[model samples]
Target: MEILVMGLNHKTAPVEIREKLSVPANEAMGFLKRFEQKRIFDEQVLLSTCNRTEIYGVVQNHAEAVDAAKRILCEYSHLDLASFEDKLYVLKQPDSVRHLFSVASGLDSMVIGETEITGQVKEAYLAAHQNRHTGKVLNNLFQRSLKVAKNLRTHTEIGVGRVSVASVAVDLAEKIFDDLKGVRVMVIGTGEMAAQLLKAMTGHGARALIVSSHHEERARELVREFGGEAVPYELFEKKMGEVDILLTSTFSSHCIVTENQVRSWMRARHDKPLFLVDIAMPRNIEASTEKMDNVYLYNIDDLKEIADKNKALREGQLETCAHLVQAQTQYFMDWLFKEFNSKIAASGS
Candidate 1:
């Protein structure tokens, strides 16, 4: 059996490219089902987020699995393989093991040592596990990968700084406004990114917090925890014009705010500056809205630019993180091939 990973991340591709493959988790189940339907790989897990989308599988033949996974991802993304193949990386065996360990440990993230990727990786694995798409090999691999993350965090200084994209986004907002004082904020989503962004911005002391969610219950929960006043999802458009900072991080499949809508809102505000931060994978705000007067729009890639400033600070700890992940990867591989050898011997091979 072979461990394989096919994916693209913020390093290899930009948001516009990655977003095309950023379907909701429910939709990712279809990718797993297709892999099963084609009998390409018996074990599969799909992970999609703001920065990357990956397909993990264990198969007998590496070439066949890689080609099939590429075509399947192209079919799901409606993108031609030749068009995006240069951005995709196909990792095999121990390399795939190393890649996943780096990811779960946040070494591969744009934020360098973000805590969010571990949770995201765990969610992806659990979803596959509950759907019965994972087996012993991947089971041990993911579980070990998680432990590697904890070991790196506990043993190193990677977690000691402003190491989250949310904090980076807030840093940019503060630079723009000088401070958060009396800055009205409207956050239009209820995902984890939304919560983190809200938490970071709240620490700066915003004058108001208006939260809207596609699901009312989640919005109410955020409001209660963040001490924000909940607003109806449909009214986000109307309320957005009233705030100085507009942050959106939702899992909606379509744009929640359009260019035309923002143009209209700007007119109603008499050209007051509106700082918009859209960290959602599919992007809740339209891309074209960035062109309008007094309208500042920043996405995940923009936040990455700010985060790069602190990457040098964490480089001193990379050796420690690498050693931990490499040790974990080897541990997984030893167990993986041991199981394979046992199965082969049991069959009298």
Candidate 2:
């Protein structure tokens, strides 16, 4: 069997494309099962994040697997393969293992050294493993990938002064205001991304925080952690004037914060500056809001510029990380070969 990966990432595709192709954790098992029923893969794991959607597998026919994965992705995204065939990546064997190692180690992230992807990788692996979707080859591969990721973090300076999307927003916030001493920061979303933004904001000495989410319980959870007020989702806009910086990371397909609402909010603020950070893939804020006066809007793509600067700062750590990944990948590959040889020998006997 051969190891194969058919996917797209932030580097290979834009946010719009990535969002279209992204498979939610709830939907991953269905996709994995589709591949099994289609006779595409012997072992499979579906890994999806805001920046990437990758299907990794151990299969007898790499070419057939790649073709089927593409067709399935086309059907799922409601777009033809021709529209994004150029963006799709199909990697085989040792390269596939190396790519997984790099991704788990955060070397392949939009913001290098961000720790979130490692957890995502583990989540995807375990989900597949628990569902009995992964066999000996995939089990060994994923376990080794996690080990390699841990080793890199322990041995290298990759985590030192790590810059994330949240930090980038904070950096921009610092430039806009005299200081965060009196700034009222609010995160209008749920999950760790929401918590991350509030943590970064508060850490920068922001004076207050308002947590809001589609679910009040999730909002309360963040409020409990961040020492903020939890505003119901419908009422968050009413508190916009009290909010100096508003970061949005939601799963909404359309803009939750629209231009008309912003107009009213600005009137309420008396045209005061309101920094808007849309870190969500589908973008929770209206794109045209960036053109409004005294309203600063930055989307996920905008964060990349600042992220690139951070990448430069962490460039020194990359070579060491590279060496670690290369060595671990080779070890995994050797073990794979040995496992395959032993299986063949046993079958012959």
Candidate 3:
């Protein structure tokens, strides 16, 4: 069998296209079952995040598997195969292993050196492994990739700065308000990103903080940890009019904040400037809300400009990261080859 990776990411397609293919963590097992029914590969791992969706697998026939994988994606996304074929990329063997290393190490991320992808990759691997969708080949590959990621972070300067989406959003908030000191920040959702945003905002001395989430306990926990009030989900919109900055990262399928709602909130606020940062995948805020006066709306893609500047600043560290990935990739391939040869000998093939 051959190790292969096929997918599209932030670099290959825009968020609009990427969102169409995103598989939430809760639905990963169902996706794996569907893919298994197709028999595309002997073992496979599906990774879907805010920025990318990829399938890494060990397959008997690379050509057949790739075709089937594409078919599966098209079927699930309801997107025409022809429309997205050019956007997909395929990598084989050592190159595939190298790409995994780059991704786990954050070198392949939209924000170069950002650490969230490491956890996301691990989560994907665990989901597959726990469900018995992965075997020896994928188990070894993912384990080594994670080890490489840890070594890269330990031995290099790639993770030295505030390169996270949350940090960038806070920076943007600071730029808009001139200072976060007196700003009333409201965060919807209690995910990691929302927690990070709350911490950053409070650290910068934001006057008031309010957190809302589907899970009221989680919201209250965050508020207790960061000195904020916990508002119930039903009242998020009603409370929005009083906030100077609104940050949302909910996992809802539809937009939580709409143009008409914002218009009403704006009227209530007397046209106060409201900076909205929506870092959700399907997007928590409506696109039409961007047209509202004095309301600044930014999604994950909009943060790419800030990410690009940070990427340039960290360009000097790329050579060191590249060398580390090359060394680790070679190490992984050598191990894989030995394992493959040993198996062949044992089977007398």
Candidate 4:
């Protein structure tokens, strides 16, 4: 069997293309099953994030497999296949293995060395496994990939100076708050990064949460599920002073929270330090807020620096991972050879 990866990433495609191809959670399993039924591959795993949409597979026909995956991706994205095909990339066999390993290791991430891809990899693997689309080849590849990733994290100091944007937000918060359980965090927007940061804080025993968004109804739904209150976007600054930690990420082109706005909120709270994490591009918080005494502000660029530092540290340990995948791939190839030889012997006999 030939292994391959076909897709576009943040490096290859812009955010516009990436978002269009991104698979939603509800549609992922169905897509995998459809690929299996079509015999597009012997095994298939789809990895879709904000920055990438990739298919890792073991297929009998590389060209057919690439075409089918591309077709399905285009259908999902509602794009014209001819228009989007030129933007995609396809890698076969050994190179595919190396590419996937690099991806799972976060070496290929837009923000190189982020830990999010490992979880995305695991999710993709699990989706394939659950649908019974994975065989010995994929099973070994994913298991070995995970092990390699673990080693990269443990052995490398890349994760040293900084971690993820979410972790950095929590790190700054932890330093300010003696206890997170009592603090209230108001998430100003329903964007993924803000949700992720809030979830991280929730896992750390943060109990009080208030979700505010332009779509108040959706915010109410999330609030109901997560057991938080829903405040309207108009009241975001009003609620800002009430919450201990304020995290914001929205698609707004203009500033949502200005330097003057945060300062005005500060006056109501007796100068209590507020942990604000801005994970939005173009930034959600004003730059001047960083200069404020009680306002600790972190932007996306700052978190990206942390991810880059960790990536540089992890690059050195990838060789050991390379060996691990090489050994596993050789084993799979050997089994494949043995099976083919047995088939030939039986036919001759």
> Model-by-model lDDT, in order?
0.83, 0.84, 0.85, 0.75
Model 2 stretches with alpha carbons more than 4 Å out: 164-310, 342-349
Between which residue pairs do clashes occur in model 3? Answer: none
Report clash pairs, candidate 2.
none
- The TM-score, computed over Cα atoms with residue i paired to residue i, of candidate 4 is 0.60
Candidate 4 on 220-293: residue-level lDDT in tens? 76676566677767666666767888777788787888988888888888899988878777777888898999
Give the better candidate number (1 or 4) by lDDT: 1
- Identify the superior model by lDDT, candidate 2 or candidate 3: 3
TM-score of each: 0.62, 0.62, 0.62, 0.60
lDDT of 3 by residue, 208-307 (tens): 4555555788877877788868887777776776699988888999988889889998999899788998888899899999988999999988876676
Q: Put the candidates in TM-score order, highest first.
A: 2, 3, 1, 4
Better structure of 1 and 2 per TM-score: 2
**Tens digit per residue, CA lDDT, model 2, 1-349:** 7888989999999988989999988888988888888988888999999999999987776677788888889889999888899998989878999999999989999778878999999999999999999999999999988898889888987875536677888878987886887789878777677677788888878854555555778777767776767777777766787888888888878888899988898999899888998888798898999999999999978787767666776677899899989899889878877879765445335
